[model samples]
Target: MSTATARSNLGNTIAAHAILITWTVIALFPVFVILINSLKTRKAIFREPLALPNAESFSLVGYQTVAKQGDFFLYFQNSMIVTVVSLTFILLFGAMAAFALSEYRFRGNSLMGLYLALGIMIPIRIGTVAILEMMVATGLVNTLTALILVYTAQGLPLAVFILSEFMRQVSEDLKNAGRIDGLSEYAIFFRLVLPLVRPAMATVAVFNMIPIWNDLWFPLILAPGEETKTLTLGSQVFIGQFVTDWNAVLSALSLAILPALVLYLIFSRQLIRGITSGAVK
Candidate 1:
């Protein structure tokens, strides 16, 4: 309100943005460098590392090599299927479990919530011994099913915890009104509660998607077979095999980055907008 106070606030805002921009540039510089050079020829890449790709220097040889040598489309499909299926399970099961914990105060409810949420702090990789044994015992070691199940287990705990917190803040009166309207508990969850918690759900979806899309561990450990390889795993293997081939490696990295960048751009506004909006409201 006072002139001095307003000026001080403005100065702080400027400093914050300066820091943020600086860090963002630092983070993005390598990615930009890799992507631009992926389009340039080998000589151009080394000679003009900081230069933009010109029409005369630009070439599509990297992309051609990647596509010709590998079944990129198949890997893309595998990733899409696994990500979608795993996310569906996480959202449905996580939301249902969260709803039960929030709406009903049954015995062991708090304890169970705490139990499940422990997975957030404890990396599931620590239990690789048991997970692999279980997968092997069940004959699912090299299957996409194995990857989906492991990711669901890995993602569910955090999903339930975040959604449960959001569910707790859902107005009790609306739930009561649904009960008074003769709706079953299941119907109430489907129509009343689920609709209200969608913002948090979007937040959870985006949160889970990035890790799953970018993951290398589960694919390598659980489903390393050629037939079951996800895009991330495929790209990694391809890059390693072609490490000395700068064009191929850079192109592979670019391809890997494209889908993730597109998805982030699409959902970023929604993920940030509603989660904070809900909290503020």
Candidate 2:
């Protein structure tokens, strides 16, 4: 390559890196500000809002207030149960539906696929009244079960849509070989096909987990009780009650953000792998 051409390429690379770094800083600035403020005293927070918490300005009063007033462990437990259970159901049902749609030649298969896909565009909030009524009738109101059911329903469509695309790419020869070996369809799915599409499943689980963990609407409507409150709902309630107390509000928000951030950091590698693997295929 000519010197000028090499220089041009280097310039472009530099520009791209610069832009990415700028965007990263912009995105993380708010989180940095919130976290630092959470560690500072209210006076320091208001006075030097952007300053990091030094020894003189630092205080744990906000965390203490939160610990005293909020049952964070219970809220965390509720979130974990709801997220895990809902994700399990979403993955199981979505994988089954996706497998059926992708592998089988059945009547109205296209129509059924389209029907399921419709949920992707349509927001579930429209059916809140009906969902609430059903929950009430079933005596599930103000319970974790209600939240789990709702989240599973909300997540299943997108999960099925993503999984079905990946499932379709499974090798026909592999499936046939499984059948010839006396493997039942269920066995083929659980052993052969499911393992192959695990990356996609992980991607789906991570995608669905964010909404389920962060959702406030379903929890508020169906399971607003203290015992059933997810972290998101509990954080909101805590902040609202302590709105005047900036320290507690900041601490509550930091607590809320920390767990989700940690989870994403852990799963982000798999998420990127899933997307890239599909693209390569």
Candidate 3:
């Protein structure tokens, strides 16, 4: 019996890892194609899109074009600022709201949770006209702040929903013990509760980061100025009505993909742990 159980567990673990590896490859295959093709000459790109860059076909012209044609660095900077700041706000406020919803029992508690969850069901883009009007009225149009605020609102529902589930899993006794030690509510929340949910927070950050970084809609609508253009928006300059610069487009996409990839690698462990927290065991 013991031997059979051990074999089953081992098999399950192997299957899990295999599935993860397969999914990773599938998800990254397009990115790999883009990255490799970006290093080749335009003619090579058309001739052998899937082939690796040979000595003769290797070129840096695409990268050069990206550097010369637009403010690539500025666009990258704007994207970084918007993504980071928006994620911070989403995590901080969403965690706080989740904690309150999960830890406290009050009148309309369920209703409140339902209210927040509604944001996830409702498409934020439906209110684009209204949001644009509000931003215009507040003079936030063409500002990074507009993007940040919109993304924060856009991400909050999912963040709260996921974090609240994880927050409820935190040990109540642990929190009570902190209170007994004369810790303030804020102290217990920050020092005790938040640490236990770091994986969940990391998960939330990764989920929201990609959408915020890659989003072209809000940036194009609200902050289309040269100074505030995100990487996704700036990449559009390489495309034209009839003659698209495929080389520059690919190079810009490669550059845009790097930061998101780096961030995912950084938080990957926590993300996996958060996602599979209860599934395996």
Q: TM-score for every candidate vs. truth?
A: 0.90, 0.92, 0.83
Give candidate 2's error at residue 21 in angstroms: 2.7
Put down candidate 3 lDDT per residue, 1-281, tens digits, no spaces.
99999999999999999999999999989999999999999899999999999998999898998788778899989999999999999999999999999999999999999999999989899999999999999999999999999999999999999999889999999999999999998998999999999878888887788889889899989999989999888877544411477788788888888877897789788768766775212
> After superposing candidate 3, which stretches have Cα over 4 Å from the reference?
1-30, 46-50, 278-281
Worst 10 residues of 1 by lDDT: 272-281
Ranked by lDDT from best down, the candidates are: 2, 1, 3
What is the C-alpha lDDT profile of model 2 across 1-281, one tens digit per residue? Answer: 69999999999999999999999999999999999999999999999999989999999899999999999989999999999999999999999999999999999999999999898989999999999999999999999999988889998888889999999999999999999999999999999999999888898998789889999899888999988999999999989999999999999999999999999899989867766766324
Task: Return whichever of 1 and 2 wins on lDDT.
Answer: 2
Q: For candidate 1, what's the RMSD? A: 2.9
Residue 165, model 2: lDDT of 94
Give Cα-based local distance difference scores for all models. 0.90, 0.93, 0.89
lDDT of 3 at 164: 94
TM-score of model number 1: 0.90
Q: Largest TM-score belongs to which candidate?
A: 2
Candidate 2 global lDDT:
0.93
Best by lDDT: 2
